[model samples]
Target: MDNNNQTLATNELATLPLGHNWYQKVASNFEIIQSYLNKLDTDEPEANNLKNKFDNMSDKLNIYETNIQAIVNILSDYDVPIAIVDGKVVEIKEGD
Candidate 1:
């Protein structure tokens, strides 16, 4: 994935679901959500309602956070997801 890191466009931010699928393999969960919507038949109002809410999840959910004086970097091309910060990577390490 590192090879493609140079190619990940910064113009737009990639989004994960509300929570459960935040860190799933290759956006499989996200694809699942989209696949359902793609098949939505407007004839079915109930399906449309469900699709509507799911579509708005990105904005409704806490997708991004900001802390004072922080360097924000986006993770990509991964099965799962995370925001590495506080001068540490792969979780917090006590000391050297």
Candidate 2:
């Protein structure tokens, strides 16, 4: 309802766990598909196409993982109340 309340709510939401588990599951699935593609006979043109698709998917997944890690790092820094702990800002309790 107020600025402090809004800030606290935002901080709480920001600290929620990112979907690392989901990303890992999708990545694992991609690995399985790629393995299957590799075992297939290379003479078939469709095999090549499927392998290429898997390669592109792997690359994009890597990029996504990196970006997610960066976001998590940034959020980890924000979770620490550095300004308040360092005495740069005082946190006033209600009724104080």
TM-score of each: 0.25, 0.38
The TM-score, computed over Cα atoms with residue i paired to residue i, of candidate 1 is: 0.25
**What does candidate 2 score on TM?**
0.38
Give candidate 2's whole-model lDDT: 0.56
lDDT of each: 0.45, 0.56
Residue range with the least summed lDDT across 10 consecutive positions in model 1: 1-10
Best by lDDT: 2
Task: Residues 56-83, candidate 1: write the lDDT tens digits.
Answer: 8855553433331132333323322344
Task: Give the distance in Å from residue 25's predicted Cα in candidate 2 to where it truly belongs.
Answer: 48
RMSD of each: 25.1, 26.5
C-alpha lDDT of residue 87 in model 1: 39
- Candidate 2: residue 5 Cα off by (Å): 72
